[model samples]
Target chain A: MKPTRVTNTIRALRFAHDEMTQADLAERIGVTRQTVIAIEQGRYSPSLEMAFRIARVFGVRLDDVFQYPDSEEVAP
Target chain B: MSKILYLGEAVVTHEEKRAWIMLVVSVIAYAGYVAVVLGRQDGGSLTAVPYVGALLWTVGGAMVASIVAEIVMGMANPRASRVKDVRDREIGRLGDHVGQAFVIIGAVSAMLMAMAEWDWFWIANVIYLCFVLSAVIGSLAKVIVYRRGVPQW
Candidate 1:
């Protein structure tokens, strides 16, 4: 697996949101289930538009859905 | 939650399985073509041989086999899942770019051979070899990218 500085709370949010499935999130985001799986596994990072879309699907802000750990630790 | 099985092994995704099928089909078709062409040569130069028939058969067979394999794969996994996504598209483009390098290499080599007044047999075979290499290497790259994570850029 490739290392990524970016991380996300999608899996947790999905579980918290009425136990939403990956397929559910994917359908809502207009992407494939595999894409959702990839994102959850940190194998892929979505585009900015997709990141916003994902946040919107969960009724959350972009920062609540995704985080850049390296940048976060450095900024503050 | 159904999965497609090939030779008793589960295939993860439609695109991955398709890559495997294309690789296999290309190899088999190319091997058959080489065998037939070389078998007719009897240790003589193959320059006089007519290869259009073999070339057509190999290319056509690979295409047909790939289509059939995809159809069967779809039937086996009838969830109507999305066939592609952003990641898939990126990986595909990466593979195509890698494979295209071989096509350029082949073209340049063929041009050099033509300048050297090589036989048509050599030029044609070189071009065909390059195409086969492109397909095989490209599909292999896609399979690798599917298994490993695609590189971040």
Candidate 2:
């Protein structure tokens, strides 16, 4: 199966937001630090609810946090 | 304070390490049981062998070893830092499902052996082997899943 096309701005956002550590973000999002690392590295994709939760932790909209390159290409 | 330096970078996540411990404990326990049983067997039918004591000892020992290993791992890592998240849950379920398949197979085989009037020793050993296979295979699956990213589905 093709790899997940989902990507996120978690690393950049974390840096922009007071240089937040991965553990700090994980604690805020109620997930393990390793999970945060995986998401940052694009090895795992979070569920929609988790995606919204992550974005909420950073005080951003869902789209601002995650992107789908395939969806973008399909857009008219 | 001096900076800590290691010869090589060895990094294993807490879950992965737990899986490894379980795999090792199960294999060692099962091997020990088999060795003792075979060593005690005289020039007689396998059905005459006394296997109950060995089976019980191995089962209990494996349980204790697994518990002790988990405790040691917990002590080594800070409790607050050890977290089980979505990926961990998914991997656990996947491993459990794979292991459970062996359990059903073993049960059916034991039932058939019993119907055929096979030796009680064989039936009991088959059941014990199934349990061990479940644990070893399940732990192995978990370790592999942790190493290789969880299936996309």
| Residue B32, candidate 2: alpha-carbon lDDT | 99
lDDT of 1 by residue, B1-104 (tens): 32211122232567777788988898999999999998888888798777889988889988999999889888986765646878788888989999999999
Give Cα-based local distance difference scores for all models. 0.83, 0.81
Best by DockQ: 1
User: Candidate 1: lDDT of A29?
Assistant: 91
Q: List-wise, what DockQ does each model earn? A: 0.28, 0.25
Which ten-residue region of model 1 chain A has the weakest summed lDDT? A67-76
| lDDT for A76 (candidate 1) | 40
- Stretches of candidate 2 exceeding 4 Å from the true structure: A1-3, A71-76, B1-14, B42-45
Model 1: residue B60 alpha-carbon error in angstroms: 1.2
TM per model? 0.85, 0.83
lDDT of 1: 0.83
Model 1 segments beyond 4 Å from truth? A1-3, A71-76, B1-11, B46-50
Question: Worst ten-residue run, lDDT, model 1 chain B?
Answer: B2-11
